[model samples]
Target: MTTFTIGDVTITKITELEATGDTELMLPDATPQAVRQVTWLHPHYATEDGLLKTSIHAFAVVTPTRRIIVDTGLGNHKMGRPVPAWNGMTGTFLQDLTDAGFPPDGIDTVLCTHLHVDHAGWDTRLVHGQWVPTFPNARHVFARTEFEHAEAAPGHGTAELFADSVTPLVQAGLVDLVPANEQVTPEIQMVPTPGHTPGHVSILIESRGERALITGDFIHHPVQLARPSWTSAGDHDPGRAATTRRVVLEELARTRTLLIGTHFPGPTAGYVIPDGDDTYRLQSLA
Candidate 1:
């Protein structure tokens, strides 16, 4: 388990799945030849043969007054998923979260950066052939725009995702549809960094003059830090996504904010540093 602290706030990673290679499905342009060119990616974000290493996990953010889980990973027993490997997953994500010391009942807030399949899968669990809220005591928060968009035009495996993972929370009256830039807490706020989805937001944590940003899907891998123009295949708007990437990276580099990638593999936290006039690299904090 990897953890980082910003002042009194503690952020711990609870991993559900991790894999290397086959990244081309998400990033078509990230071929082995192209990925090998980003020298900074070697040994951590990328393999020797040039395949990108990625992870699917959630961050347990504990502030002085609240405990929150951000972006729950692919939950177990989800069916009809587009990705064969992601379907019918039987991982010990809930136990893993408990072992990390942030039990489901202890979490008072469940924040989803966006309503994507991988990000919102664990919102509910199958119980006696019925879907139920996993974090029963917590209020599940989602951006209004994202929720509406996904409801109207569900994206890859999102139909099943909504039927099982998301709808249950709404039915139980545990969902909070907030604005894109709502203040989650004094130390944690949503930073509107859309384009991966219409209402996607990156989380910002600030306390005691220290700051960190939990990147949603706006910037997937470290290679995107170097090539901000490269966008994921799942991007809702490629042009806007690329623009957001460039702008976000510039600000991150300028402010020297600790960047915590949502899907980044081990050594996931880093600092964005300028490589040249227009490019940048991630200086891993691990």
Candidate 2:
């Protein structure tokens, strides 16, 4: 139930799952030897044995005029997923969100950074053998390029994801395809940080002179802050992803904006501090 206040805007973490080790599946280059080199990662982002820690969670963002849920995590009873553990997940994600004061019906917007399996799984739920939109009253938002790419050639397990989670929303007329840089609200704007996906976007929240950035997949682990060149194995364009990471880290570090990592472990919010000429580290806000 971690929460952060950026002026009048409030962002709450609604955790669905957390795990350690098995990072190589997402980051092929994040070997034990390589992860151990970043000393600051110990105890939170990584273990002493060099296993990376990560979480699957959604953020409940509350502004003066809107209640938004950013990135619904892997859903329950999802079949044919590449990862066995991710399939048929029975976690209390919706209950957790409700307990945190953001119920599905109460959410006015469902903002997906990208339409990946893990990020958009909970967009729909299985109801009487049919997939249906979970947030019945909220508008499911997606980047136009992302929606088109996933529709045409959904990669790996994404074909099933689109059919069960994404397509249902579109069929229900609850989807809103917008540009990558669409302004969600006056205080919440989408920051185009592509490469992880063709239309990947990070969220930017600014209000009353305070600011924060919710990093989607462009920067997976805190280790990327130290080694900006290390890209996720799932990245659509590794080189471009690395470039986006490096550029974003520099700007965030310079402005000292609070960085909220979408997959970052507990104590996920932080300040991107410049560690070296071209390297940075997250100074945990927790």
Candidate 3:
């Protein structure tokens, strides 16, 4: 239940899953030797054997005005998911959230950065054999453009995801489809950082001069922070995703702002500082 406070806003990392494996599998472009050479990533981001530590988690953003669950991790009992391990699986995501002090009903907002399988899975839960919204009292927010794009151009895992995790919320009439860059509250707003998906966006939290950006899927791993041009294979548009990463990373480094990457493992929340003119490093706040 580690939490970082920005002004009055408290952001907690509630993990759904944690793993350590190949960095090259995720980054592809960055081989073991290349990644190992980064030096700063060792003992935390990478193991002695060269495995990369990764976490699939959500940021429970507790603002003065609202309790927002950002990016629900891969849900349970889901089927037809593209990833073999994610298919028909179950996890303790909700119970973990409750244990962290934010119960399902207590959450006032569910902010999804995008409609990807992992980020949107827990948007709903299995209820009496039916998929339903887990947070009964929350305004489940999504960007209209992202939703529409996911619906019309569903890809691997996207169809099943829309059918189970997303559509159910829409049917429940709890969905708030706002403009891609709309602000949810005084302290919370969306940043349009597409390329991960057609309308994928990142969440920005600001309060009392302090700031942090929840990097949805814009940049998957810390290596990408150093090698901004290295895009994920899953990226909808690798080129655009790389572009977004470069711009966002530079701003984060220049401003010395806190970065909470959705899929970042080990020490998740950190600051991006300039390593050289063209690259940067992740300094974990944990």
Off by over 4 Å in 2: none
Which is better, 1 or 2, measured by lDDT? 2
TM-score of each: 0.99, 0.98, 0.97
Residue lDDT tens for model 3, 1-286: 7788898899999998888874454678777767777788788787765566788999999988899999988899998887777877777788888999989899989998889898988888888999989887988888999989999988978999999998888888899989999989899999899998988999998999999999999988887767788878788898999889888998988887899888887778899988887799998986
lDDT of candidate 2 over 52-84, digit per residue (tens): 999999999999999999999999999888878
Candidate 1 local lDDT, residue 19: 93
Candidate 1 lDDT over 1-286, as tens digits, reads 8999999999999999999998876888899999999988989999888999999999999999999999998898999888899989999999999988988998999999888789999898889999899999999988899899899887688888899998889889999999988999999998889898998999999999888999999988888887788889899999999999989889989988999999999899999899997799989986
lDDT of 2: 0.91
Cand. 2 TM to true fold? 0.98
For model 1 the TM-score comes to 0.99
**Ranking of models by lDDT:** 2, 1, 3
What is the model-wide C-alpha lDDT for candidate 1? 0.91
Whose lDDT is higher: candidate 1's or candidate 3's?
1
Model 1: residues with Cα > 4 Å off, grouped in runs: none
Ranking by TM-score: 1, 2, 3
